[model samples]
Target: MSNEQKQYLKKLKNTKIKILFWQILLIIIFIFLWELLVNIGVISSFIFSSPSRIFKTIIELINNNNFFIHIFITLKEVLIAFILGISLGFLIAIILYQFKLFARIIDPYLTMLNSLPKVALGPLIIIVCGANSKSIILMALLINLIVSIITIYNGFLTTPSYQLKLFKSLNASKLQILTHLVIPNSYQTIIASFKLCVAQTLVGVIMGEFLVSKQGIGYLIVYGKQVFNLNYVMTGIILLALISYLLYKLIVILEKKLLKHI
Candidate 1:
């Protein structure tokens, strides 16, 4: 590589490191301020819940042997919903891309479904799926599937028309054209959809848990609210934030690896 290119790459790396450093620093400062305010009389420790209080709550949950169980349940539900949503969405998007008439026909319906508030269906879902993990997974699917289909299908739609015509003139099969040109070019869009689906799936899972779960972080938050123990609520929120951040970082890693292979 040229010296200019090497220097550019080094500068980019340093920028990323600087951004990460600031992010961590901001979180530390926020936590320190929170603890300090709680220790003083500025903020109510009972309502706001200090960083140390949240730490103690974590220890208490660990001692009770319920912490991991809750985390495991929520993670499992999220994983299942996420995988199903993406797989089905990808397949359906391919179908829509191949059949233009079908795509046009369902376009309005998809938009309507996308705009619908999924939480409103919680009662019906609980009634049908019986207040279990099935309901949770189904809720998440409903939330994420339409979005995945729309995002990926739109990406596929952006495939170059000249390339499509060229492939057609050469008697290339639609499958060959899609595999070689469409999907490869849409990797970024698919990855973007993955990120969106991750967030949507989490929201759906939590909403389902709020409605009818016996275990999971959502249930813990609800339980804490019922008993007026805001620390547990705060702890659940913090855990969720951490989980979301980790999941997003994992997706970023996946994107890098996939792009490298491409």
Candidate 2:
């Protein structure tokens, strides 16, 4: 590599380190401020709760051996929903791309479904799928599937016409063109949409749990609210945020590896 490129990469690494340091520093400051506010009577510890109390609540749950069960249940739901949603969405998008007439016919309906509030259909979903984890997974699929299809299908559609014509001139079949050009070109969009899907699926799982769940972080949040235990509510939200961040990072790693192959 050229010295200029080496220098540029070094600078970028330094910049990333600086940003990460600031992010950690900011979080520390925020948490310190929150704890201080509650300790100083600026905020109500009884209702708003403090970081210390929340931490203690988390510890209690851990000691009781209930925390991991809840986390595992929620994680399982998210994983299943995420995998199924992406797989089904990718296949459907490919099919739609292969059949232009069908795509055109379903375009409006897809948009409408994507725009609809998944929560509004919560009761119907639970009834149809039964009041269990199945319902939760189905709810997540409903929330995630349409968006995934639209994002990927649009990416596929964005393949350059010139590229298609060039392939046709070479006597390439439709599958050959798609595999060689379109799908490869759409990798960035697919990864980006997967990132969005991760978060959306989490939301869907939590919403499903809210409607009908005996366990999971979502159930903890709902139960906390019912009993006025704000610490559990805060802890649930914190855990969800942590899980989402980790999932996003995992997807980023996946993207990097896939892009390397591409």
Candidate 3:
């Protein structure tokens, strides 16, 4: 490589480092200020729990052997919802794209469902799917599935017309063209959808938990509110944040690997 290219790369690396440094510094400063405010009686710990108290509550949860159970329940719901959402969405999108008549027919219905607020269906879903974890997964599906189908379907629609004609001229079947061109070309869109699906699934699961779950982080938040335990509420929120970040980071890693080709 040329000296100029090496120097440019080094500069970019240094810039990334500077960004990371500032992010950490800001978090530390914010935590310090928050603790200071709580310690000085500016904010009551009962209503607004400090970072230390949040950490302490987490520790207590660990000691009680309840941390992993709650985390696991939520994670299970999220993973199942994510998998089903993406797979079903992608499959349905392919079918719709191949059959333009079907696509046009259902376009309005899909649009309607996507815009509908999913929470309103919670009770009906629980009534049908039962009050157990299936309802939670279905709740997540209600959110993630529609979003995924719309995103991927639109991405599929963006395939170049010239390329489609070329494939047609060569006597390529719709499935063959889709496998060879449309789907492969839409990797960035699919990967982007993954990030959104994870978050939506999490939201759905938490909402479901709020309504039906006896255990899980969402339940903890509700229970905390009932008992006026800000520590529990704060801890539940912190854990939820951590879970979201970890899921997002995993997608980032996958994006790096897949998007490098882009």
Point to the candidate with the largest lDDT.
1
Clashes of 2: 0
Ten contiguous residues minimizing lDDT sum, candidate 2: 43-52
lDDT of 3 by residue, 1-262 (tens): 9999999999999999999999999999999998999999999989999999988888899999998999998998899999999999999989888899999999899999999999999999999999999999999999999999989988999999999999999999967999999998899899889989999999999999999988888989988999999898988898999999999999999999887967
Model 3 / residue 123 / CA error / Å? 1.0
Candidate 3: residue 76 Cα off by (Å): 0.8
Top candidate on TM-score is: 3
> Over 4 Å off in model 1, which ranges?
1-17
The predicted structure with the larger lDDT, 1 or 2, is 1
Model 1 lDDT per residue over 1-262, tens place: 9999999999999999999999999999999999999998799999999999999999999999999999999999999999999999999999999999999998899999999998999899989999799999999999999999999999998888998898899999989999998999899999999999999999999999999899999999999999999999999999999998899999999999998966
Shift of residue 37 alpha carbon in model 3, Å: 0.9
Clashes of each: 0, 0, 0
> After best superposition, candidate 3 residue 22: deviation in angstroms?
0.6
The lowest-lDDT stretch of 10 consecutive residues in candidate 1 is 253-262
lDDT of 2 by residue, 97-186 (tens): 999999999889988999999899999988898999999999999999998898999899899999989999999998999899999989
Q: How far is each candidate from the true structure, as Cα RMSD in Å?
A: 2.1, 2.0, 1.4
Cα deviation at 126, candidate 2, in Å, is 1.6
Candidate 3 residue 205 Cα shift, in angstroms, is 0.4
